[model samples]
Target: MRYVKWTFYTLIALTVFAFLHYVLPQHDIVRITNTDTRRIDFGENSIFWASPDAGTGAAQATRDVKFIETIQQNGRPMVYRNEDTGWIWPPYFKFNSYNLQTEASDLRSTSADPRWVVVTHYGWRNEFFTIFPNAVAVRLAEGPNERIIPWTNIVILTLLAVAGIMLRRMWRQFRERTLDPLFGTAEEVWEDAGDRAGAARRGARTSWGRFKAWLRSLGS
Candidate 1:
């Protein structure tokens, strides 16, 4: 049982970590190699993709998805799909897919004279299942070795910590205001009952002693 409880807690922690890692924004500095658009079919791998364009009821299983081709500073190639996440989960509020496509196209560079860019995006690029991260914003970087501080991550974690503290304080307040009073009343009632029982027992003992004394006098 103890092992099972620890295993359950570990799974829950891992799930939360995965969820935050997926939903949070991350920055990648890379050189734009090329750009393309192709039709993608979101079948069993649908959960890996974001929601349809904003204000649309439902999205079809297949659609034309934009691609931003780039190469990282480490000489590894990376591809990101430019898609409108709409006003949904993760809440980037991004609706400028066409503009972003134009920007990425303009920033395209070759291997010889690489034009570095900071791709502010959220999601994951998986090669096996064919999933690409969604780009939210792009900016010109000084060079391939530009350092970007993760303010987004810091702010998000701080907000989560504040929320957790507030929730714990609220729970404690509710117990003090609501449940504590009832428990206090129950304790008082139990103490009073104990006192009454003690008095009744003493009175019975005194009456029995008098009865014994009277029987002894009668025998004499």
Candidate 2:
């Protein structure tokens, strides 16, 4: 049971971490390589992609997904698929796929001029899974060596911490108000039962002593 409890806690922690990593916004300082739209046929990996265009059916397997191509500070190629999250899961509420694609196109620069742009995005760029980070916003960055502080992450973690604390307080209050009183009543019942048992034993002892005295008197 102890091992099972620990395994359960570990799995919960890992799941929370994965969820935050996927939902939280992250920054990538890179140079825009190009921007294009491709008709992507999402299959089993459809979950990685965002929702289909707003007010449109999500049944189609093939759609024209806009993409923002970039080269990172380390010279490694990174591709971001620009899509509107709409009013769906992850709740980005982003409906500016066309605008972002245009912005990415405008920000494109060669390796020599190197117009570094900060891509604010969420999700993961996994080659094996064929998933790209969904770019949320973009702006021109100073240089490849620019330092970007993750204020979004800080605020999100702080809010999560507050929520956890609030939940813990609620649990403690519930235990004190409900479980503690019930347990105390049970404890009192057990103590009262024990006292009754001890009194009965004493009563039986006194009766036995009286019988012994009567037998002694008859013998005398």
Candidate 3:
């Protein structure tokens, strides 16, 4: 019985650990916008340089000129251009254009941009690359989705509920085994105690008799 109790406690501890490792970290649901344009495009000379005569020069020209113009108009393009890579934008680029005041409040409230954007520049030889906008390269706490209860979370919680039920059943069984004799009209424990007491008394008498015999023999 003691071993069983220990085993159950150990299992409970393991379950708690698993819950912490897998479940706790997943408490908040991550709702990503699933933006369509978030992708890495690569190819041979896909990056075209603007003509030297063009405004902003060849260095400033980008294949995604239209997209950049749209972003610039909004004053929050969240668009990144790399000389090596064409155009890069977070999945949230479209959200910036939405008229928040006119759209459904829920949509406006829920929209968000990705927390971070990374731009990598690869050399023509593909041997070396650099990231641009070095001064403000990193953005934190800007992901597009809010946390929602994930399915894994639901499954873990269900398992925990089942475990709780099993624990309750075990407790009932344990109480029946330990407390029935004391409070459930069962005389088995009292009877066993009385039998043990009688045996102890007999053992004491036998010991006394043996001690007397030993003393008499010593005197003789």
Candidate 4:
């Protein structure tokens, strides 16, 4: 049971970690190599994609998704989709897909004379599943080796930690003031009942011994 409880807790922690990792904005310093748009058909991977452009209805199961292709500082290829979140979950509130695409296209560079930029995005790039991270914003970087501090992530995580601590403290206080006292009272009652039962058994045994002695005296 203890192992099972720990396993359950570990699973919950991993799930939360995965959720935050996918939803939170991440920074990547890369050189924009190309920008293009592709028509994608919705399938099982549709949930990974955002909704239609802002103020537009869902017209069809397929739409043109803009993409920004880049080369990382390590020379590996990376691709990101540009789309409007449009009042959806994760709440990036991004309605500037076209603008971002233009910016990315403007920042496009070649390997010989690369212009590094920081791409703020969320989601994972999986080739087997054909899923790409959605780029939220882009900005010029100082250099290829720019040390970007994830201040947003740090602030969000700190607030979450503080909230968790506060919740735990509240639960402990509730248990101490309410549940613990109720259970403590019940436990005391149970111990008192056990003591009374033991005493009654001892009294009955003494009376039986006295009756046997009286019977033996009368027989003699």
Candidate 5:
């Protein structure tokens, strides 16, 4: 009975835990949607342009311009955009500021007059800083679904529930075994022993008196 009680309680506790784990989102993947530019105060007197992307906006702008020249290079999508002006890949823009900077520096070193080198690098850098943060925010805002539950977590929870039930049963069985010897049939056994002890005392008293009489007779 004790074991049963514990087992029931353990099962209840484990069931609650399992329910919570199942209901709560653990792993989530968010899709990027739209990109927007914003002006932010970065302390001091310096002002910078930042671009952020929207994850769930339907009215995002779509540009049909080919940024990458080769659509398929080694069967993989290659970036082919205008060499002079970098394009935004809405919702999933690549951080091409570093690449732009390298390209601008090379152009300056090779050419007699550096044209739009600095301007191109600055543009790419500004977009990279802004859009990356926005995309991250959108990803964070998205929630996880039930299908994302890990198999290991499920198995662990199931085992915990089973162990709780088993432990409760074992405890109950142990309690019953301990109580059966002392309370189940031991009452009758104790009563019989008490009666026998009384009879033994009465017989001893009578035998003592008979022995005294026999000794007095021999003396006379």
Candidate 6:
């Protein structure tokens, strides 16, 4: 049972980590290589995609998605899908895919005159699933190796930690005020019953001793 409890807690922690990693904005310093639009048919990997642009109404099973291609500082290739998250999950509220694509195209440069930009995005680039990270914003970087501090992530995680601590404290107070008293009362009742049973047994033994004394007197 102890091992099972630990395993359950480990799984829950991993799940929360994965969820935050996917939802939180991440920064990548890269040089824009190309910007293009591709028609994608929603399937098993559709969940990785974002909702339609604001005021675009419901999303269809098939649609065109804008993509920004880039080469990272380490020379590794990365692709980001430019789409509006609308009012859906992750709450980026981005509705400017066209503008972002235009900006990416303008920032395209060659190796000799590389225009490095920081791409703020979420999700993972999985080649196996052909899912690309959704780009939320893009801005010019000072250099290819610009130091980007994720202050947003730090603040959000801190708030979450505080919330968890508060919740645990509330639960402890509830147990002490509500549940603990009930259990304690039940224990007192059980102890009292035991004491009464013991006293009854003692009374019975004393009565038996007196009856035996009367029998001995008669025999004498």
Q: Which ten-residue region of model 2 has the weakest summed lDDT?
A: 52-61
Tens digit of lDDT per residue, candidate 6, span 100-134? 98988988999898899999999999999999999
Off by over 4 Å in 2: 55-57, 187-220
How good is model 5 by TM-score? 0.25
Tens-digit per-residue lDDT, 1-220, candidate 1: 9999999999999999999998899999999998899888888888878776655558898887788999998999999988888877878888888799999999999888889999998889899998889998999998877889999799989999999899999999999998999999998999999999999999999999999999999999
- Per residue, candidate 3 scores C-alpha lDDT tens digits across 105-179 of 221212334222221111122223321120111122234243344565578678989998999999999888877
lDDT (Cα, tens digit) per residue for candidate 2, span 47-94: 999988676676578988999999988889999999899988899999
TM-score of model 4 (CA atoms)? 0.87
Give model 6 RMSD, 1 decimal. Answer: 3.5
TM-score of 3: 0.26
> How displaced is residue 41 in candidate 2, in Å?
1.1
Q: Give the per-residue Cα lDDT of candidate 1 at 13.
A: 93
Q: lDDT values of the candidates?
A: 0.90, 0.93, 0.37, 0.95, 0.38, 0.93
Tell me the number of clashing residue pairs for each predicted model. 0, 0, 6, 0, 10, 0
lDDT digits (tens) for residues 132-178 of candidate 4: 99999999999988998899999999999999999999999999999
**Whose lDDT is greatest here?**
4
Error of 6 at 144 (Å): 1.2
Q: Stretches of candidate 1 above 4 Å error?
A: 54-58, 176-220
As a whole number from 0 to 100, the lDDT of residue 136 in candidate 6 is: 88
* TM-score leader: 4
Candidate with the larger TM-score of 3 and 5: 3
Ten residues in sequence with the least summed lDDT for candidate 4: 51-60
Off by over 4 Å in 3: 1-15, 23-145, 174-220
